[model samples]
Target: MATDSIGNVELTDSTPTDATAFLIEPPRKRTKTTSGRRSRTNFEMLAWLFMRLSGIVLVFLVLGHLIIQLVLDGGVSKISFAFVAGRWASPFWQAWDLLMLWLAMLHGANGMRTVINDYAERPGTRFWLKVLLVAATVFTVLLGTLVIFTFDPNIS
Candidate 1:
């Protein structure tokens, strides 16, 4: 080993090594320099976990909703405003719908955010896309929640 001008000890390969070995670059040494940015949090890990859990719950919720609203009794034809009113009148159904609405909206918004983050090349474009996604999600969730809670069957 010989000391180079930069103080790095260079290893002289005296042996006739394979030609391919010379083509590979040495691994870079990492320096402990701070860029003044905060360290990464576990937000990505938590989001991944939430996506999985919410997906499982959404499957059950969506399946139950489809079965109850489409397969039971006389099918879609039987579903009217009165039918919806009656279903909403029950606390259990109300809770179920509320949960489904919230979960679906949140899950979809998160998925769209991920897509936008992955595909949007420009920082400004990504920001605006996420903002639009959040706005739509909030509006839909609020409107659905209000309708579910304040539904009245007496409207003639």
Candidate 2:
């Protein structure tokens, strides 16, 4: 029994004395469940790995892009339509842009999905939020990819 400062509140420490309570349980270790036992896939693990790898790749891609577009040569003033056309004309630049677009979009969308899953209390809310996130990501990726591949320097 104990008394608090607020008032004379009685307290009882009723700790469990069963064998189970006294037994030292080992920390939980995750084992890969057989497909027959569980249908859960390794999606979370893969998503975590993707986040790390994409972050590293994005550092290089985004830094290079910023340096080229905003810092090198005459800086932002030199980034004219013709400048963009010239850069996109090269296959290497095109591929770089495409990879950057895909990785950035996917990484951002995955991050949003994780946020939604963690914060959204309702299952329906989570599902719809993820759907919207995925739809927007897919749309943006497709549009960016189309523009990158189908860009015409001759457009007046």
Candidate 3:
């Protein structure tokens, strides 16, 4: 058994034959992290489902937003603060923007988390990356929601 520089874990070349290489087999059943015990929660499955559902919803939301904001406006020059204020004055439009804001932020954050998990080999690096991701996601969501709901139109 060879150990890494950390001198804690005993690395071995042997791995379970059941865990065939990627693409050759479906994903192996997930177990408890590092403990070899079975995990009770299906967090990963829920996240995967969220990604798929949100992606579909986002496609429609983004397309509709684009059509209304850009193409129907006859280009970017037509968009103005007055136009946005008028749109947001309606509760329905406010809700629509809020939903889009939340879904897009969460969808992007989850994808980034997956990327960090896959690429960040070091535990410390992965942890910090996710912490930053969560912080940024929360900050953006809060800021965006605040801007949408508390928009003050009187500012000259």
Candidate 4:
């Protein structure tokens, strides 16, 4: 084990596998205090954490939604235009669906963004892909919100 000037054992060369050579070089001492480039912020960390939290919340929201829409009362038979109108008339159900839509889309989109960032090696490609992802996410969320708020059952 080679110790730096600070006496910390370096693990850089400890791995002898041929594949390890292709990996990013171990950070050098200068990198620890480099000032030119901005360090990674907490956004990615928060995004990962959010994915986990949202996934858990989505489980409950989805299950409750499934139960109410597909398993309660008379199952799918109870779900008619009037049933939907009545449900949407209540602010509670509207809020529930809205939350579900927003959370699910954001969670799934962020997950895909992470995947793209990891796999897309080119900066330009990643930029355009993320732009498309953001546009789609925004469009879907906005369209769903509009439909939820503007649904008019009384219209003949």
Which 10 consecutive positions of candidate 4 have the poorest summed lDDT?
25-34
Candidate 3 C-alpha lDDT tens digits along 1-156: 556798766645445556845586565655466577667899889999999999999999999998898888577778999988889989998998999999999999999999999999778999999999999999999999999989987768
Off by over 4 Å in 2: 1-38
For residues 47-97, could you state the per-residue lDDT of candidate 1 as single tens digits?
Answer: 888899999999999999999889999888899998998888899999999
| Candidate 4 error regions (>4 Å) | 1-36
Name the lDDT value of residue 141 in candidate 4: 97
Q: After superposition, how far is residue 40 of candidate 2 from its true place, in Å?
A: 3.0
Which residue pairs show backbone clashes in model 4?
none
Going through the candidates in order, what is the number of backbone clashes in each?
0, 0, 0, 0
**For every model shown, what is its TM-score relative to the native structure?**
0.75, 0.74, 0.76, 0.71
lDDT of 4 by residue, 1-156 (tens): 578999887899566667556647664455545676865799878988999999999999999999999999989889889999999999999999999999999998998898998899777999999999999999999999998999998979
Error of 1 at 8 (Å): 34
Q: For model 2, which pairs clash? A: none
Weakest lDDT window of 10 consecutive positions for candidate 2: 10-19
Residue 149: error of model 3 in Å? 1.2
Best by TM-score: 3
Greater TM-score among 2 and 3 belongs to 3
